[model samples]
Target: MRLSLEQIIRYQTEGYLIVENVCSHAELQPVIEEIASEIDKRADRLFAEGKLAELYKDEPFERRYSLLHRQCPEIGRGFDIAGYLGDEIFKLLCNKNLIDLVECLLGSEISCNPIQHLRAKHPARGSADGSSAPDYFQNVPWHQDCAVTSEDSEASEIITFWMPLVDATAETGCMEVMPHVFKLGYLNHQAEGGTMIVPEKLPQVEPVLAECPKGSLVIMNKYTPHRGISNRSDIIRWSIDLRYHKTGANSGRSFQPSFPVRSSSDTGSVLRDPDVWRTLWREAANGAGRKIHRV
Candidate 1:
């Protein structure tokens, strides 16, 4: 599952690469089922508490979240990798096929950064006046991965993987990236909606649409400028973002927990227990406060 030399070259030169069919549907079923089960658990409770209208039990996994959200927005909260740390997701973090590709570019040592997130970008209600959707559910503005991290990690080569649980198409609001922008060095960022790259500081270049399919991932360099557009389609656009950097490097999120996922030199450091992962997240949640991520 290691990437070819040419593919690695493209990733270095272009600052991004699309690797399709990295995992089969059978391999993805575990996470999908786990998420579906979570939805059922939450929906049932919300219904009992009179917060939700109906259970929407008949709806499919991809569509159920949207239905539940339409009734009550709380359904979308606290569902990230850090929120629950499910066994399946922790396993996915150490997925062999994924780590092989990561090892190809990052060598044998790899640490899973704590900036992971599962984005369920629901479709925009309508285009007229723009519906009242949360920032997480709305169109993501143009930005670079490096801008979200602290200045301490400005030199770390943090690799990002945006893997869709379902097919991500242009109509469904796939991510668009400015290729080769990494060569421009770090772009100036400001306190915009979400600490985005300054508009006047942007380079004159067109963006490449990353319409990835299920089981596929779009690999990106830390400085690659990218954004997610509005999901105009009928269904939700589901995707998870995972990051890895050289072991012992400052993981942008100093307050969050990072785990050694692959270590050829020291196998003992690689985290293999889901309980430990959950415990680490719980500890972080209790002690971590609102710290200035960017200077």
Candidate 2:
């Protein structure tokens, strides 16, 4: 998964790499099924209890939307992705084809969070004029994840993995990135959710739409200025974003990376050693047990 020589240069220069089809539909089928099944099970249980609608009766749309998973299957706030998505989710998150690319760009000794999150959009009524109504596109505007956290400058040594479960297109609202923006260094994002490029510091390049097919993985430095597209299409746009930090780099957790990355995948570790990676990969195949069918 180590990046190609060109990929490294491109990343250093453009601040992002759009690796197409990092995972195939076949590769992602199991996890997609698992996620959909989880959604159905939770929805069913809540409906049966006659408390689903009442749960958000008093909340605003924004808060209600954000808290949907909370009232169902815990989302974020001490979220352990490995426990939920199971090992394959972690493998997909740490797959060498992509991790190698990340290590090449960010260096070795990586520590990744096991929290895998899904963002989906469904059809709703009377949406904003230009906003994609109903379907929830994962795009959260152009802002760095670090900007929202209390972690200081040193936490910039991180990369993000955005894996889409469906084809990400312009119409469907894929990612839009300002190439080489990171080379200008991290820009200060305004408090009102707007980010601007440093004036004349970096040459301007037209934003590129990251139209990737289902299972494609995009890896980029955390400081890269990027944002999600609004899903104008009726179909749901689903994706999972996984973040990783270098072992010694500041992770915003008191300036120290949290949790040791098992150098091997045997115990669900995502270490950088090649031999360990192979061993763990094989273990994944044998231990996958039965494929979890999608709902």
Candidate 3:
């Protein structure tokens, strides 16, 4: 989990680093199983409502959602699962390996940014020939994480970890990033299908596909310009995008609460109770509405 000097340097030089096997299957199983359970519940409900003919009970986690979406395209758009701030998810957020790698970059004091999401990118039937038929959510446009954040956090050094539950290949809409663009700082982004870097301002560098195996992580800075491609494969791409930054630093969006995950200086401040962590998100979810720049 602790990154080597070369890995740290690579992240600094290229704006991203793919850390293979940062976590083991044992460490990831709980989170994966929790997601699979949620999928099963949804599948049952859809089946009862006559939306899905078969539950695909024997299908694996990677294929279940895609199969469900294939049978009922109407269920695709609303399939994105939020409220993942459960106990299992919190355990993954505080994973020692992940935290150690993050500490190497952001120091010992770490705050878990609230702008995290578990993305289940279903298969797109459309051709990969630059077609517009792909669902907007399946194919994310080019954009920097910082661009989607509030303006006040422009200077914050937020480290993002993109970890896939299944093997993510180019065919499965693995992330692609423009090398060394983080050094250039935040770029102008506009809302297309999603918040994206302006077409004219996109980096000219050839994008590198971040193909990663299950339990691996693609770590990037807030300014890294990256996007997910359309999932042309048959299976759904299950990935979690989590963010962390130095404790007490701005979390981009002040409206959402960021909890201390690791704090050597103030050990008592570290969140140990999963219920408390879940409550933080529950309060935010129930609080007054604010316009958030969706990524």
Best by TM-score: 1
Residue pairs that clash (backbone atoms under 3 angstroms), model 3: none
Model 2 residue 190 CA deviation (Å) reads 3.9
Cα lDDT over the full model 1: 0.86
Best by lDDT: 1
Model 3 misplaced stretches (Cα beyond 4 Å):
72-84, 126-134, 285-288
Write one digit per residue (lDDT tens) for candidate 1, span 268-287. 99999999999998888532
CA lDDT of each prediction against the hidden true structure:
0.86, 0.57, 0.81
All models, RMSD in angstroms: 2.2, 10.2, 3.0
TM agreement with the true structure for every prediction: 0.94, 0.67, 0.91
Q: What local lDDT score does residue 108 receive in model 1, on the 0 to 100 scale?
A: 92
TM-score order of candidates, top first:
1, 3, 2
Q: 51, model 3: CA deviation in Å?
A: 3.3
> Per model, how many backbone clashes are there?
0, 14, 0
Candidate 2 off by > 4 Å: 51-87, 114-116, 123-139, 153-156, 191-205, 254-295
So what's the TM-score on candidate 2? 0.67
Clashing pairs in 1: none
After superposition, the stretches of candidate 1 with alpha carbons farther than 4 Å from their true spots are: 127-136, 285-288
